[model samples]
Target: MLPAVPDRAVDELGRTEGGPETLGLLVRDQHTRRLLLLRAVLDAAESAGPGVCPAAALARLREDWALLEEAERLEPSAHRRGRPYRDGPVSGRPDGSVPVSEGPRGSVPVSEGPRGSVPVSEGGAVPGNRPPPSPVRALLLHPLTGPWARDTLRALRSGTGPLTGRDTREPARALAHFGSLAAVAAARAGVSYAVRLTAHDGVLTLPSLGALRTGGPGSGETEVAVVHRRGRLTLRRPGEADVVVRLQSGAGAWSEAAAWTSAYTLPGLVLDSAAVPLDDLDPYRTARGGPRPDTLSGPAVLDEADRKHWLHTWSGTAAALGLGGERRLAEAVTLLRCLVPLAAPPGSVPGGAGGSCSGTRREAFGAVLSSAPATATVFAATLVHEIQHTKLAALSEMMTLHHAGPEARHFAPWRPDPRPYDNLLQGAYSHLALADFFQRSALAATLPTLRDAAWAEHARYQAQVGAVLPALVGSGDLTVRGRKFVDRMVEVYERLAEQPPPRGHAARATAYVQAARALWTRRHAPGE
Candidate 1:
């Protein structure tokens, strides 16, 4: 027989005497706001005097800001009528009952800050009591809510196919364990918890008598709710097609059950729990026990700090690019920031480029050509073009698990062609392609000054490529095939330039695709 449920619930039947539980969140929000302002100030200071300012001072400010923001953001919003409200827009809306973070008791941790903490909904009245008309099918859990709820929520949304995918299953299993603990706690507190498993068509709904809701795509919205009670655990739903849960203080009424439903359906209850090793559950693990391709690593696996850095760099670069609208610039910078780490490594750096690589490249290295006006535009386009080349190369490397070896130079195998010479030609063409593509699809999306920048670069690249390529290929020993390859590469790009701008990404992407394939096909031709 199980013990009585513990009465350590966040909510107590204290009647009207209890003051509001949400006042703490306001304090947390204040800290968060202050931190944001500090970050902005630090960014301005660093940008103002990149060389003059001490690196330590800048880093200190940034760290403090992040720490404070996390503490504030991670804290649970005071629950109002069972729903949790996070401090920022990033948090799901006010009526969202999704648990932000699991509490220490396997319940939702009431997050007060952005730190590694839990966030509770704003209101509370126990969610399972209000069941939606239709059978619950799915549940979305917020990361800020209960650990088990958040974990399970992550699992389902990730779709490694439920019991698979490390990101999905690991969280699910953690959630399960947390649910078990919560159940034990609830049992002690005289509250019942139960688990109900239902399957309709291919969809599997795991319901508990707790609050749960799915978040918007990528928003990490709260999706599931968890509750623990004495006797039987129950999982129910709030609406149709969405899964919810409810828990009551009773046991053993498994009658008239639907084939889709089996056993306990209460939050924090696991009737017959089984231990599944986290590694085995994740399908991303290979037969050899190695991680699969999509496994998180490096820049592909960006943390919050990386995300922030990306945003900062992108905003700075876009502004430098002379993008007029700050809002558009900010968004573009954010996207670009996401893409930067994924960008190709431009040749082996002599050593690691410091944290502010892109910034230093812009301000110190000075890629922008001021005199020729168009020179800056061409440089920007070329950089983007080369960046794409790197992206393509990286993708290929990941697919093959091998990097491409340098092709033997036709004239002198011992002395390879310089990167600059190659990059100059490649970048020129790429600039044309990217500039043209952006102009067509995202015209309004980009600031007008960008077009002027691109045009300037186009002219500069054309002049440089025409002058340099001839000298590089002039060596008498250069092979016909090699010469043809180079000539065709240049010629095709010239033709591509003359052709009208591509209609959309499909057309633009296709242009590169076809050209590359054509080049490859030409290489294997019989006449060679």
Candidate 2:
């Protein structure tokens, strides 16, 4: 049997009890799920056809899988767990990949603060003149979340006759990525092998590693040459430049290799991460205004100005976190891996004096789709709020918190319409965090103006949590564990509530909730 989260840990997470340690366990669980999905993808391809997904391509995947398995056997801990959430979106793009760090368990460490320009924290370099760390997980994940994998899985169940050439090519093309990833592994282990990869739109992508310009129609073989021998990689193709990547000795950030390719590695505040590129290089990357999960605004690609703006905001956010407490910023960095920027909503400023925290996001195990922040506080608040979604999604996947049922009738204080039981739970948990954030901000705010704003926001969210809690418990959706989870959450809520509301803030918040509920009832109540 696969590893199970200890019952105690689950309950602790339910109540928002455990800190980063608990969150780490949840992140680890996500890594396991990604692995299972990888196996599923490979199996699906294996059973399909030598035609749909080329025989040669499938064979290379098998070869790499063998090597990865051997690596795991040699160092079982290397595959134990990977970086947390940053897979694909939750709804349309579920079952995406998480980058598993290759090395002994806990061998990789997050970089400390920002580096010179890139904030990446690659752990110890490989000793002596060895190759780079394995690119196994990243190799699998990037393509798996892209349209190709989605279509491949869809076609398998389409029940439509044999897949058309159009359908077959994407998976075939996806299979080609293994060549690039395998090359990295071969370089790391000093193995000898060759794997030819085809390109899409003239780009040969190696997920999490890098890409090469393989100029040809999406159909032809773009590979110039792929030869791996005796610790040297010779990927020279025609007149094109060779695949020249500088491998770091110790376990390096996967984003670092991406620097060699078209991928844009984001220079984070204290953490290092990469933007999900839209260069044809990343088959999964969505173009501007591309279709996305309904909960998301279309993800925006960064231009030069946007990239600079992103980094500057991050610097401000880091400063904001410094005031909130180390734990606050620390937790945000740990939960977030990728930021999918969305166009800012009209009528709202991106950066007011304080941050807006108004980014449209979903609980994708991978990204937090956001707009630019209005203030550092808004950026900080967005992190605090989104991390709740991250935790709850992982928790739900790890174990059932609620029974299977159609449960969209609960009153969520934040929404005008009645939300599903799941939505209600997520909203309440996040409100709990929002209340906590404002409380911390109110205390930390030096300027009188800022302190008052923080206190008011704190009151409002605290009241929202209070109003929603009873509705959540009364929904009859929670299972035994779910009940325990909510009950524990209530304990935290009550403790937080004990801190007296600011001035008449309590009455104002309650009245505001009541008025909103009354309006909702007029519009949505039974028989309306």
Candidate 3:
């Protein structure tokens, strides 16, 4: 059973007056927040008439504070805040057990009702003069741990929907549109959801109720139904025999059942604590970056032990880097879904391999780590590098940075092979982040040896960035927006370079980058 929600509680909007108690539930649990938001939309649709008045919704939320609070004191810490992604075992069933009948659960059957099916108009304002309703007919689910959440909430409160290029409408059509929009947003955001919608008898059903699945058969399933009861809105689900769990009023009774299935065993990767072996690789795994094998030849799972150790390392790194806020840390982790282990090829470094698929498969932004890292520091650094790739990939979708043309391959200091303009941009952005990470480490280092090592790393990354920035600026491949992006990157590097490192370390780092460039030119240049 879940803990009861506080009566006087804050929501994602920081509104403390009477709102839906479920918002309090969403504030507490980051994993299930999206599911609850979906539930709210379905409920609102069932209750609303032809038109959904934003004013009426807001008024209802304000008057219903008591049911949600229930005498429990709402604490600030109960709200979802940014924290390091912990690898500790996610305690719960992979697919939560719902008390439903023993049978193969299929899609809900559509049935006729007394009111009859109301044919929803495709898109337009209501016939009569009613104040423009909220654009967000479907509730927007914000990330519990990132800056995006705050931005989304602000937009929602201001009567704007996060989804673009969609016609907002009454409840039935709005629910359908939201399902499609959410899937697109999740793919772009590097997140995944098990969302399925079925409409029957003027009601909608969310099968799976926001739980992530491993696609294994015979797993238990839960379905949430939004229906009208005696002209009042109610959310219903099956319970013990002859008993149905019906939730009405503003109280958040269904909050406890929402659980986050963070870890599971995929075809080629084991996320969280699952001990399943990888027999075949998922086709979604990208072929770029690292070696792509047909099947698993060696260890391909991120086990429980490694997860705990790496999370500890990440926590320490975040503290050292002054990234204590939930938003900052969540920015890194929210885009990172899972880590898969890979076997290194012959004659290659065993434990020093990391590959990101953000460029090719933006939807599957999980990193494939080659062999477990020898230390937490290595693992943390690899995570930082890979997630940066995901961030840049998402940004590229929003704004076109480079011109569309035949790929212009160029010499990259880190990769042995020549890289295309897009890949080059990805590397530059990631290395810039690495430089920031090292700078933070250097500043926070307690011992002289550690400080010196950190400073050397910081200088090395700066030199690499300095080398790449010029090529990016001169490539002539960047669009106007692309040029602006590269210019901002250059500005950051210039600021960091102003903070000079130890004289000897700076010289060596600069010389190393120059030599690497020279070697690349000799090999890859025309008529060398």
Question: Which candidate ranks first by TM-score, i.e. highest?
Answer: 2
Provide TM-scores for the models: 0.22, 0.72, 0.46
lDDT of 3 by residue, 1-528 (tens): 224433233111111111223222322242233333333333343344433325443332222111111111111122223112212111112232211212111111111110011111112111222221111111122111122222223234323434453323322332342342333222222221223332323223221122222223343333433322221223344561211222222111122322212222222111111112111122112232246443233444345665554455444543442321222233332233344455444454644443212122343323333444555455555555665665565455444678745565677887656778887888888788778667767776788987888788888988888888778889777876566667767776777777778999899998998889888888888787
Model 1: lDDT of residue 260? 26
| Candidate 1 regions with alpha-carbon error over 4 angstroms | 1-311, 321-347, 350-433, 436-522
RMSD of 1: 26.2
Cα lDDT for residue 30, model 2? 57
Weakest 10 consecutive residues of candidate 2 by summed lDDT: 84-93
Worst 10 residues of 1 by lDDT: 9-18
> lDDT of model 1 at residue 237?
42
* Candidate 1 accuracy as lDDT: 0.28
Question: How would you encode candidate 2's per-residue C-alpha lDDT over 289-320 as one tens digit per residue?
Answer: 23654443444556778767776667688667
lDDT of each: 0.28, 0.56, 0.40
lDDT of each residue in 13-130, candidate 1, tens digit only: 1000011232223223322333333233333433533233345333433332232232233222311233222222122224422222222111222224322112222231112222
Regions of candidate 3 where Cα sits further than 4 Å from its true position: 1-299, 302-317, 320-330, 344-360, 365-371
